[model samples]
Target chain A: MPYVKIELTREGVTREQKQILIKGITDLITETLNKDPHLTHIAIQEIDLDNWGYAGEQVSVLREKGITADKK
Target chain B: MPYVKIELTREGVTREQKQILIKGITDLITETLNKDPHLTHIAIQEIDLDNWGYAGEQVSVLREKGITADKK
Candidate 1:
């Protein structure tokens, strides 16, 4: 059983996006790792901005300073 | 870096319980795997019953059929 977990900031991601993520990950695992798509379990965790930290600062605080994790 | 993800049904789990889980898992990994607690990341995912599947059925369906996953 291949279990894949994706954690992201709770940035208003839709249910359809989550479905696509689950399906895409399952397909990738099946193709590369030879895992069964039916047995693959994928979970997406949408963490709160205050709960997620990076570089010793909370995401919420970083956002206040116009800093973000996105590469743009 | 050690990353641990815990997934459970969205069944009224409190924030305190999640804190406990994160701390406990970090300690366990530090002690057993010699991982640094500072480098350990723990995430808890609360999933909807209809989104989690087991045994060819969703958890919501299993609950309706009186087939609970909890071990007594």
Candidate 2:
């Protein structure tokens, strides 16, 4: 069994995005690792900014300081 | 660095339960794998039943047929 997990900050991701991610990942694993599509499980986790920490600071606090993942 | 991801069906898990799970898992990893707690990451994902599949059927459909994880 191949299992993949994706964690990202809660950013209003649509259901279609999640479905595409799952399908894409499943296909990648099947092609790259020769895994069965039916046995591949992908779970996407959306963590609230307040609950996610980076660089010793909460992501929510970082966002207040003009720091965000989308910023270049 | 140690990372753990737990996936469960959306069943109204309380915050306290998640906290306990995180703490317990952190302790287990530290004790067993000698990993630093600060570098450990734990994510709990609660997925909608329709998004999770089992036995070639969606979990929601299985639940409708009275097949559930907690029934055992």
Candidate 3:
């Protein structure tokens, strides 16, 4: 029942990568949060750079400014 | 962390309503998914009626069709 949603700028991630990311995150949730992996729900939103803003800047600009530079 | 994401058609829900929904969902997650409330992450996306679809119909139409009519 724990649902996780991720909103990010559209990128070159493939379906395989998406699956891996979700699995990894779900595994981490089970380990760190003591959650049941079977019941966890995850959703990812691929948003346009212009549509997602942070700190008064679009995600693209913020990435260039090193805001999300460390996040892979 | 167990992250929960909810995407729904935009409704006239207030901030208090939003908070209550989040809390209730989080509590359910804790009970059902065995997650810790402190580490659980929940995100809600409010989309226009035209943006969300289910079972070959928009959420609005689906609701009228009694698909999501039972979900409060």
Candidate 4:
């Protein structure tokens, strides 16, 4: 069984958005790995800005510095 | 930054159990990967028996057949 998890900032997520993501990711992984959807487990996770960091700084700090999604 | 996610069958789980798991996993990953707890993100997702499957059948179906946690 292939367990898939997606991580993103928990900013704005609607039930509809999550539903679409679940379906899309399931389709993508099943297609790529040739695995059955029944056996594929997908989990979506939302991360708080302060709890996640990159470039030796929290995501919140990076945002304060006007950093875009990409690394500076 | 490392993101860890744990997936288990949603049969019997308590808030205390999840709390313990999150801390233990966070510590393990931080120590093994040399990452900061502030930078490490952990998410736990529980799956329903019907939504999870194995051995070419739904987990619920397998349970009906008296299959153990391990494969037949």
- Measured by lDDT, the strongest candidate is 2
List of clashing residue pairs for candidate 4: none
Please list all clashing residue pairs in model 3, or write none if there are none: A3-B3, A3-B4, A3-B5, A4-B3, A4-B4
Worst 10 residues of 4 chain A by lDDT: A13-22
lDDT of candidate 3 over B2-67, digit per residue (tens): 755666677665555555666677777778878766666555567986778767788877756666
Question: What shift in Å separates residue A51 of candidate 2 from its native position after superposition?
Answer: 0.7
Candidate 3 runs further than 4 Å off: A60-72, B1-72
**Local accuracy of candidate 1 as per-residue lDDT tens digits, A1-72:** 976667789878775666566666777778988876678776666789999999899999999999877778
Kept native contacts, as fractions per model, are 0.02, 0.02, 0.00, 0.07
- Per residue, candidate 2 scores C-alpha lDDT tens digits across A1-72 of 976667889978876666667667777778988887778766666789999999899999999998868756
Every candidate's lDDT: 0.75, 0.78, 0.67, 0.72
Q: Give the worst 10-residue stretch by lDDT in candidate 2 chain B.
A: B50-59
DockQ of each: 0.12, 0.14, 0.05, 0.10
Which scores higher on DockQ, 2 or 4?
2
Tell me the lDDT of model 4 at A68: 60
Q: Identify the superior model by TM-score, candidate 2 or candidate 3.
A: 2
CAPRI-style grade of the A/B interface in model 3: incorrect
- What residue runs in model 2 are displaced by over 4 Å at the alpha carbon? B1-6, B11-45, B50-72
* TM-score for each candidate, following the candidate numbering: 0.56, 0.57, 0.44, 0.50
Q: Model 1: which docking level applies?
A: incorrect
